[model samples]
Target chain A: MSDVYAARRGLLRDRCAAAGNAAALITRPANVRYLTGASPLGAVLLVGPSEDALFCAGAPTGEADEGRLDEHLRVTVLAGRGGDPAVAAADAASSVRADSLAVEEHHLTVARHRALRSVAPKVRLADLGTAVEQQRLVKDEGEIACLRIAAEIADQALGELLESILVGRTERHLALELERRLVDHGADGPAFPTSVGTGPHSGRSRHRPSDRRVEEGDFLSVCLGANYRGYRCEIGRTFVIGTTPADWQIELYDCVFTAQRAGREALLPGAAYREVDHAARSVLDSAGHAEALAPWTGHGVGLEIDEDPQLAPTAMGKLDACVPVTVEPGVHLPGRGGVRIDDTLVVRPEADGGPELLTITTKELLAL
Target chain B: MSDVYAARRGLLRDRCAAAGNAAALITRPANVRYLTGASPLGAVLLVGPSEDALFCAGAPTGEADEGRLDEHLRVTVLAGRGGDPAVAAADAASSVRADSLAVEEHHLTVARHRALRSVAPKVRLADLGTAVEQQRLVKDEGEIACLRIAAEIADQALGELLESILVGRTERHLALELERRLVDHGADGPAFPTSVGTGPHSGRSRHRPSDRRVEEGDFLSVCLGANYRGYRCEIGRTFVIGTTPADWQIELYDCVFTAQRAGREALLPGAAYREVDHAARSVLDSAGHAEALAPWTGHGVGLEIDEDPQLAPTAMGKLDACVPVTVEPGVHLPGRGGVRIDDTLVVRPEADGGPELLTITTKELLAL
Candidate 1:
């Protein structure tokens, strides 16, 4: 586990050197968390020629990361009241005689960039630019172990939810209940806000839970995940809320289930990202519901719920083994609701049992 | 309200023109919501020499706005499936033969900036900087009206929580209940994650809720806010768990209440931001609790929960009339726990009352 984070920093350091940078400043929270295994509020990672340091606004007071930090990492707690830590880091880098400090221009605000310039006038600020993100696209076995536990936690939470009498509960209450269940199952927190869309609200992407109650014969779409030890995974399932599903509801559910299966089956190494999205999107597209689709059929997930190697139409990447991504696609009728089936799966070569399905929640339309 | 949004845009346009730019692009969410009446996720507003246009990722999908587009504004809904709307806006400005465009470099990511450059190579890019944030420092009357409602909703939520059984309820459940009550009282959402700390967790700044439950003879500190029409306001109170507070609990509560009141009273039309913070800090400092104090006692609230004119010792700004802020001062004694009292108020002249209190939640420590 310690080797995973240290190796990530080592790779980043090599990329920084290749770009003619003696050191790199990381301000993105996800990247910071990835390299140092410790992400305090407003923390930055300074990977230099001499040593690697984690500079935080203040020390984190949470138990989300029990074993993420190791002795190899130097944790520098910034004073509670001080100027920007990035500026302080720039001055430190300059004083250490590190030439050409590369920074994540995408993450740093222009004002913060200007402050860094003022603090270390002699240090050159170069663009690091998505180097660490590319490094994080694939997961190591230890990271995958964390993701496995995260998925198990999500499964337990969702399984408990399935056993409950869900009728007459509002989407908001159900979402809150699922979140509490996530924490009860020992997750640091819900990876993202739980999405519980019911009745006319089902199948919408990232639907904000509302007061609309679960009704008889209504479509209930529930999507949630858990974050365990800095690793996160997702699972979504659409259910029928009555003894017998309506014909339209059953048909829509089957279509989405089939589409999600197609996307899952197409997850081999070297498969074009768009090909996976296309395989699933065409299932819904051929059925004349193309206008109701989301922009991406699926996306990579890791430290951040949504990461790189997006499975969209113009996404410029190939699927690699060990990269975990969610193949979620759905179609929603404007007024009558719709169905969406999703699962988080790690891309694996056919020789290694195809893709490793992390989120094993059943896609079968359940009736309660 | 329409006129207020229009006038806000006009002010920004004037500033851009003064800086020798005829067109400006605002990509920051809060700034976009402040300038335009709507923020439809991933949207950007383009202020031009002729007419203002809001380029959105998608059309409004809710009854929140109900097609009441301002007559003075032209709204362009992008039909594309994937891409940054800022690039579309820069292309539009280029198509219209605009020579140069000012962008919110402070908000725009370097990748997004590069996309803007690639889309419109003929156009020159300039940093609009924090002009919108500057305009947002002193909110308009309409914004104040929304903040007043937000505060009222928060107060109602907290008041209702006091009437319920508190003992044995987990911090997560209590936080969720407060959020549900906020929505029930007409809040669009919680201003931020509702903080409900108990026992040892009580009075801690930025404490994320946990599985800890309320117990007898424990201190219960809860901080929450409501978001109504994008305007946010905060209120926090520390209460005792037993039928009667201990002598130490009473002393701590009185000290926090005094500090909060002093900070609120110092919010005059011409008071320095640091002075308001000192008025609060001095009370706590004299009580021998300076070591446990937070960096800032209070901060302005509007489209964003933490806005300009921060009430901190190092903050450099004077309070202006119409500036709404929250004076929140707390002390956390490691093993003993402590107290915090917070309230949102708007700075005003003496003739109209020095600071108009928005949150009417009682400051008295209640035992439940």
Candidate 2:
């Protein structure tokens, strides 16, 4: 693990040197964790010409979720409270006599940038842009294993929820129960807030669970994920509440299931991101529910629930092997409810048997 | 409620005007929520010379937890995807012909600030500093009422947990059960992650619950909070797991209880923040436990779990009437367990019966 972290730092250093920077500062928590094994609260990683250092405001709490710190990298604990780790990293870069330091402009606030400049007047500050994010687009076998386990945990939670009686229960209670089940299955926590929408609220993305109770003949949609060791995975499914579904419910469910399958089948190495999105989106568009679609059909997932390589029309990128992404597409009819089917899969070449589905929960419309 | 939001925005406008800026941009979510009733995802509030407007990248989902948007303010939803609301707010400020725009430098990222500058080249970008936070230091009666209800909900959750069997249960499960109970009693969610520590993990502030199970003769410290209608309150207590507490456990619990009471008693109008912290620290320090103390004894709680007016040794501020804060002090001995006592209270004038304790849970040590 230490060697893996050191290798990641070495790659980031080489990228920084190519961009004419002697040192690069990473303040984004996920990015910091990707380069170094651990990311303490308010911690920053400075990959420099001389040596790499991890600056933290306080000592690491040794929590399992925070990951283990790399022993090869120097760790510095600030002496006082309320100190900015980014600024401390900048000062350390200056002390190492680095001519230029590249910082993640998308993560550091304007005030902290100013403070860094004031503290190290001789060190030139440059924007590192999304270089680190681009590097994290592809995952190694170790990271994919974590995501696989996370997806399995999410599946077990959703599977257990379906076996229970969901009718007459509030959306809030169902969501809480699923989260508890996830933790019971050994997940670090929910990757994102569990969404359980019933009746008119079903199929809406990221819907906050309300007090509305599940009713017969209503569409019930649940989207949940689990965070295992630091990797996150997502799975969403929509089902009917009663033993028999209405005609409109069956039609909407079949349409979404077909579109989702098209999106999943389009996942391949070297495929354009928008192409995969179009495979699913075109189905909904032909069905005349285009306006109700979310911005993207799917998005890359890893250390962060939402990452780069978004499968949107305007998204620019090509899929690479080992890139894990979600293919979620849904449509909500104003007062009648809707359907959504989502799954987490890793892109692979045809020779390797295509995209590996991490979340193995059944997508067929189930009447619970 | 709409009038309250308008009045808050009006106060912020006046502050900006006094600082020589005709327009101000609030990018911080909590500040935006404070100034305006609603804070949409990725939304920014622009308070200008002509009128106040909210810039949102997407349509508001009308979620109850997101609050209601003030009708008096104009809401402009961006026409396309991937557009930043802050940059749009800056462009709107420039269109209004404001000479300068004050932005929250502590919240806006450097990349976002640069984009704002590029979009509004004529308008000078000035730092808003912590003006909005300063305005939030003293909450109104309505906010206090919300906080009071939140405290009640937290107390209810903690009380229910005490009635359950605890021996041999994992800390993770106990924490999850407490959070589920909070929502069961009508909390939007937990204010922060519930902290449950057993044995060696007890009495540590912000301790991430692990798989450690409760055992007899062990000290079990649990801290949990509830967020009701956006207002948050916290409470913590430590208990002995067996029928009888050892001499050390009894001594530690008494010491922490006394320190917490001292801190609560010091919460009066015109009392210095550090003075309140010292009232608690002096007790533990005299008992030769200074090294085990956390940075601050307590802090204000409002829209955010942790707010301004931190009660720490280096903190500088005076308590004001209607200010809600927590008085939590704990000591953690490495191998042996310790104790912590925490409660939320609101400062009031001496003539008004001194500090009003919102979290009315009994602080007595209980052996379960």
Candidate 3:
């Protein structure tokens, strides 16, 4: 693991040097974790000309949630409270006589950036842009293993919920139960807030759980995932509440299931991100639900729930092998509830079997 | 409620005007929620010379957890996908002919700040500093009422957990169950991640729950809070897992209780923030636990779990009436568990009761 982290930092350093920067500071927690294997609270990683160092605000808590620190890198524990690790990183860069330093401008606040400039006035500050994120776009086998476990945990949690009596339970309670089950199955936590939408609330992306109870004829759409070792995977499914499903509910569920399956099947290496989105989106669009569709039909997920290579109409990118992405497509009617079917899959070349599905829960429209 | 939001915007506008800027852009979620009733996803509030407007990335979801959008403020939904709300806000400010626009430099990323500049080339961008946060230092009665309810919900959840069979349960399970109870007792959600530390993990501030099970002779420390409406409150308590606590446990519990009480008693109007911190910190410091103390003894709480007017040794500023703050003091021993006592209280005048305690959980050393 330490060797992997060191190799990641080495790649980042090469990228920084190619950009004419002697050193680079990574402050975004996810990016820091990607390069250092650990992201302590208020920690910053500096890939430098002399030596790579991880600067933390205080002593690391050695918490399990915060992954193990890379032993190959030098660790500096900054003394005093409320100290900005980025500023300390900048000062260290200056002390090392680095003429230029690159920072993640997208992550650092204006104030922090200004402070870094003030601390190291002689050093030219440059934007690292989304360099680290670009590097993280393709996952190694180790990262994919973590994502696979995360998906398995999510499947287990959702499967357990299906076995229990969900009728008469508020959306909030059901959401909470799913989250508890995720932890019970050895997840660090829910990748994101579990969205349990019942009745009119169903089919909405990222819907906050409410107090509305599940009813006999309502559409119950549940979207949840697990964070296993910092890798996140998402799975959403819609179901009918009672034994008999309404015609509209069945139609909506089928449409969404087809759309989601289309998106999942379209996850091929060398495929344009927008093309995959259109493959799923066109299914719903032709079904006359274009106006109600979410901006993106799918998105990349990793250490963060939402990552780059968004599968949207205007998104500019091509899918690559080993990239984990969630294909989710849904449509909601104003007063009537709707359906959403989502799955996490890894892009794979046709030669290696197309699109490895991580979440294997049956997407059949079940009438509970 | 609309009037309240309008008035808050008016206050911010006046402050921005006084700072020589005709308009201000609030990008921080909590600050946006404070000025505009609702904080939609990727929303930015623009307080302008002509009118206040909220720029959202897309149409508002109208989710209950986001609170109600203020009717008085004009809302603009960006038409395209991947649009930056802050840039849209800057464009709006430029169109209004506002020569200068102030932004929360502490919240806006350097990349975002640059984008705002690029979008509104003529408008001078200035740091709004902590004006909104300073204004939020003294909360209104309505905010305090919400905090009171939040505190009550947290207390209810903690009380319920105390009566449950905690032995042999993992810390993660205990924390999740408490969060479920918080939602069951009418909370938007947990104010922050619930912390349940057992054995050696006890008394640590913001300790992440792990898989450690409760032992008969272990110390159990739980810290949790509830988010009601937009306001948040916090409460923490430590207990012995089984009856017959050791003399060290009793001594540590009493010491922490005394420290927390002292800090609460010091929450009078016009008291310096550091003075209050000292009142609590001194007790622990005198007991030879100085090195193990957390950075701050307490902090103000409202829309966000941790807000302005931090009670720390080097903190500047004086406490004002109606400010809801938490006085939490704890000492974490390296090998053995320790005790932490936390409470949410509003600073008040001496004649009107020095402090109104919102978290009414008993401070007794309970052996569950």
Q: Against the hidden true structure, what lDDT does model 3 obtain?
A: 0.90
Clashing pairs in 3: none
Prediction RMSDs, each to the true structure:
2.8, 1.8, 1.7
> Candidate 1: what's its TM-score on chain B?
0.96
Per-residue lDDT tens digits of candidate 2, residues A1-368? 87898998999999999999999999999998898877877889999886899888766665423457666788888733657888889988998889999999998999999999999999999999999999999999999999999999999999999999988999999999999999999998899999999999899888788899999988999999999988999999999988899888898888999999999999999999999999999999999898888889999999999999899998887999999999999998877788989999999999999999999999988999
| Chain B TM for prediction 2 | 0.98
What 10-residue stretch in candidate 3 chain A is worst by lDDT? Answer: A62-71
lDDT of 3 at B185: 96
Q: State in Å the error of residue A119, model 3.
A: 1.6
Q: Give the distance in Å from residue B99's predicted Cα in candidate 2 to where it truly belongs.
A: 2.7
lDDT of each candidate versus the true structure: 0.87, 0.91, 0.90
Which DockQ-derived CAPRI band holds candidate 2? Answer: medium
Candidate 1 lDDT, tens digit per residue, B1-368?
57877888999989999999979999998998888777777888899988988887764544224454577878777643676789889999999988899998778877678889999999999989889999999877878999999999999999999999999999878887898788778887789989989998899876788788899999999999999978999999999997999999998899999999889889898899999999999999999998888888999999999989789899887999999999999999887877888899999999996789999988878887
- Separate DockQ for every predicted complex: 0.42, 0.59, 0.62
Model 1 steric clash pairs:
none
Ranking by TM-score: 3, 2, 1
Query: What TM-score against the true fold does each predicted structure earn?
Result: 0.92, 0.97, 0.97
Q: What would you estimate as the lDDT of candidate 2?
A: 0.91
Model 3 / residue B341 / CA error / Å: 1.1
